[model samples]
Target: MSATPSRYCHLIDEGEVFLERCRRILGEIQAAEDDLSAMTTSPRGRLRVGLAFAAGLPLPVISAFMERYPEIQLDLDFTDRMVDVIDEGFDVVIRGSELKDSRLMSRPLGPYRSCLVASPVYLQNRGIPAKPADLLTHSCLHYRWQNSGKLYQWPFKKQQAIQAGESLPVTMVCSNVEALIYLAQAGRGIACVPDFAVKDSLADGRLDKVLTNSLIGGSTFHVVWPSSRQMAPKVRAFVDFAVENFSKGLVS
Candidate 1:
């Protein structure tokens, strides 16, 4: 082959880059076509999902989803810490906190409220807390936030005197809401938790509400996914299913 002049050497490098870019574009087009075909045929793919630790308590939703979509494989990650939907490659994430990321598209699952609860035995032994101030004297089962490493503040609507920095009489601290519920049921201490989590215990006479008039905390859950021009079929199916089921008083 004839030796290329120095002036034309840069063109060779640019040509190589142009060819690489063309290959990349073709690969992307093929992937997009595959996605479209899958959508039109059936929602079948590996779906990576992240759920808040407490959100996993609704086993029926998970069970029903799996039963309905046997072709789709589910990869679930349960954690209390915030997960990045894009960076972590999660197709969907269900969380009890407010949606702050503008890059995510979200659908409201439902609202859930936190309340003070203790075992019937515990209430008998320590006496029912008639007011929010009474918690200072009672053994409190505290939930420490996984992300911030701080205790969850029990929101008492009537007790403005209870400052944020004020310490409660903490007996046991856990990051998992289910553990705290179990501890409360075992008559360890009074716990503040979401109402949906302790529904069975309350129905079975294992736990009872405390300070119902004063203590109040609630938040809506959201199903979030990365924003895109078009959502994958599997992701869309899960999001719609969650919204439909959860809206029927599942979380509330």
Candidate 2:
């Protein structure tokens, strides 16, 4: 029996209807995918960070960033000992000075100055040393790097030349910055440390700056992360926020 033309027309109409439904479903799927992509790229995750104790100046920067990106969870590990950010599983790291590592990318957050300081009680008890050479006579607090085999040398400026040869008479040597700073605050001995760490104490008369004109060396604070983290939304947001706040001197 020959097929009717109406039957053929009906089959063609049904095929058209099926194609139209498929196109509609595909459009809906595409729209759903776009929505998912937007959400996936959004900054929302727990961000682990590492920072030196001396780099606490960036706390306000973190606070400001949190205000803008409420979805990111922040975990800050503040310590003086260095850690491999990538290997240690840290998303970001705030270092007190420029990093020389070729594996990581860093942004200049700001510069900081270190000062030789002592408590007034200690200085009063032991006369203030007028020169870097005189620090040899004074009981000086020494900061030891766990990674560096040697004790930190007291770097000083003399005349037009940078002199780092003058090693202080070390009465105390410790790895913890907080402990050493506390001892300095308690009038144990003279200490050379970041100015920001003792800014409050210096202002409140608990600590006094010694050899204000001489500094170890000027170093810039940096926000460092693994180069692989560039595309991470949380890391990107944090880095941008840190640069904005720190560079403007708004946070620190």
Candidate 3:
């Protein structure tokens, strides 16, 4: 045993040296792997979305998206004016009506119907319009967009007889939908508002619909984004989530 001590000591020293080399190589490999992963990972980005007041009815869907993607920042601007998403740097726009712009990519989410409504007090005070022609004799609430420089016309399904020749008459004009509804609630005039806005009022006997036969056809709400590759991942993810959730009847 005493004669073998030198050989045993030499072998122990070599084994320790080999382990030290193995550890150094593994450390270098790990560091290299971490650097590679850092290069491949995508950076977080901000997404801004615009919505019309009518589109706010689906806030729950938007909120769910927020919960799912906490890393992405969301900015929402609510207005009726059609915003230029590219010029203004918005990533997405949720519009209340069918989109017609050729510069953007749009997907229809769902449709919503409109009803002509007046407060019962107004109906009692000024009588209901029997037909579209009868609206000429009543006070009307008009929404004139401030920026668009266009009047939001009251829409109705016209009979084949009058579709070719006549247009509905307007008596008074306002600039905002909420104000128009307020004026109608105050018994000032009649308003053509979306059913979502007035459903509770209608159910609670605060508002009554008029000209049911001439109800306005539904408007299709859409999700729009610039048709460009520059769109970030967050924007695309949010848009996909919205379309899915809205289609599931989770948001209306």
Candidate 4:
């Protein structure tokens, strides 16, 4: 049968369109397979993590992870500085990130409760603070943020709004929370550090919690990673493990 010239051209155009669609579908299929493999397959690579100095709480669990994946190596950076995860080449950062960037992915660990604590000796010598307002007369160990150049104030319960009338000044200050805890333990002053940081001391009577009614609202920790079309297997593995175990009770 002799086909009209227009009909023949239309048939050829349709065939071309169908072939292009097939190519696109195949490409999508391949991408899906790659993503599946990335998640299901055993990952072997180095993971660089930036964290707060209080990594000890969650880090203990990482020892088990290492035993499971002997091929994966870890590089840790324990500093309070707000790390540039993407520019600094950190595979992941576990910190109290604000999570404002749209170009990043995050998983919340959990909220931390700030505690007003002092060594037993400090309390014995200085006398325990009867109320949040009493902190004005007592010495305070301050936390100075390196990135912001701001001293953290002791956050008290909103119910005691009168007690938290203003941010009190500190006599002693440092950038390290651990240092502040150590100084507090040495009876230098009462330190307002993350509850996670002082759990052991509080349990063993090294540190005593004062002003129990006026607890500070601490920030939530998150596992943040750079957003990409193809997430690395190593990054996924660590993020999942952290969210499952380190997200809660590491401090509680």
Candidate 5:
């Protein structure tokens, strides 16, 4: 005899629940397999990392990491844009901004300070900025934010009050920090940049610090990854390596 209509509906509901249970069981089994594999084998897989543009820490860290783990291959993406860790399939992302996503985990690498820098020629020709207000008259190389398309603010300590529509004189604008550094080194204009990126230049006298006592923009770099029940071996290794290397005050 044929089942009643309500009985058919009940069967469909039961089947749906059964499929869901099966899917969940399969997921658990896969997770267990992954954990077992990770435990048994060394970190030897492709690791995708997202890095901020022109952050000085990547070169040394990447070189050291590859030397230490020769089996693991690295895929690096460098950009100033904010990346989605999980959705973008990045195993790790290093950024100078604070973490906002609750689904991700972060480890602080170190702090970096920003300062206004210019070539000696530029300073001599344009005159050194005695204070933050003097920047209004000097040619400024500005950094345009990749995500917001707005100019990066020159965070100066004890900033003076400005008139209704006063702003720094912008001679050029670019999104890449390295480009700004290059231009500043070429005697183009004064550019605000992370101090670590110009350490050698400052030491060799290729660039001179401007408004040294007034600029106060700095932030800590963080290595971020997706939150998981068991962190992958490759991700764990890199995180530990980064923390150890950066703890030595290498990045300034």
Candidate 6:
């Protein structure tokens, strides 16, 4: 084969780059021109959503939504592990962790609340505490953060002052909310848990809330999704639904 001239090779390279630039410019123009009315007009399509189970199950709300919008199919993933939204093609995720991915858009649902609880049996044997400082002497159950390898921080307002991230001794450490509460119920130790996790326990007389005044601050729940030029109708619907319900005191 004959060797191509250097000038022809340079021209070929420049031409390829020029075409690429043109493609990017056209893509931006198309994105800018994308119509949002398409999303507002109709809601139809499969919406893949994920949520942190430890945060609390949203089954009741999601069930109600299914009845309301039968046209939009919902695929729910209830998990503790953080799933990659863009790579996994999830339309939305309910997360308590601060969103680090700038590519994703987030809407704050509300803040979470932490409560200190122990089983009725455990408190009877171990004796009840009068303040947050007394908790240091009692056996406690912990939720070990998967990402940090450390037990999740417990916050408190103590001694007429705010003392957050106060660490205490623990008898057992695990990530599961049910198992943690079960341990507390079995008279193992005091457990610092989300209020939503132990609603049944509180009602059934299995666990009793301790240090109600010594409240712990928690992460805010957020509905996040990959940001795009034109929002999909299903994604928009769910966002709106979540915001409306949360605003009306559906979930605390």
lDDT by candidate, in order shown: 0.84, 0.78, 0.76, 0.82, 0.86, 0.80
lDDT of 1 by residue, 1-252 (tens): 355675589898899999999999999998888768757877788999998757346467878899999989999988888888899999999988766888999988888889889999989988987767677889999999888999998887855436566777879998988899888989999998988888888888999998777865688889999987667889988998988886553444
Ordered by lDDT, highest first, the candidates read 5, 1, 4, 6, 2, 3
lDDT string for model 4 (20-88, tens) is: 999999999998998998888887889998887672676665776687678789998888888888889
lDDT (0-100) at residue 134 of candidate 2? Answer: 73
Instruction: Put down candidate 5 lDDT per residue, 1-252, tens digits, no spaces.
Output: 376988989999999999999999999999999888766678879999998756455787788899999988999999888888999999999888767899999999888889889999999998998877777888899999998899998887745533447888889999988899999999999999988888888999999997777866588889999998778889988888988885453454
Q: How do the predictions measure up, each by TM-score?
A: 0.80, 0.72, 0.70, 0.85, 0.81, 0.74
Candidate with maximal lDDT = 5
- Across 11-96, the per-residue lDDT of candidate 2 in tens digits comes to 99999999999999999898777656644797889999888655356677778888899999999888767788778998889887
Model 3, position 12: C-alpha lDDT score: 96
Give a tens-digit lDDT track for model 6, residues 72-186.
9999887777789999889999887657898999998877678889988889988998887788789988998765677876777645332456657878999888888888888
Clashes of 2: 0
Give the higher-TM-score candidate: 2 or 3.
2
The candidate that wins on TM-score is 4
After TM-score superposition, the amount by which residue 172's alpha carbon in candidate 5 deviates from its true location, in angstroms, is 0.5
Question: Per-residue lDDT for 1-252 in model 3, tens only?
Answer: 886999999999999999999999999898777656544554246788898766247678778987888788888888788788779988889887656777889888877777788999989988887878777678878778767867776677756113545545565676667777777788888888777767767788888999877865777779999885344567667778888886554125
**Candidate 6 off by > 4 Å:** 1-33, 157-167, 246-252
Worst 10 residues of 4 by lDDT: 160-169
Residue 177's lDDT in candidate 2: 66
Residue pairs with colliding backbones in model 3 are none
Model 4 earns a TM-score of: 0.85
Question: Between 4 and 6, whose lDDT is larger?
Answer: 4
**CA deviation > 4 Å runs, candidate 4:** 1-20, 158-167, 247-249
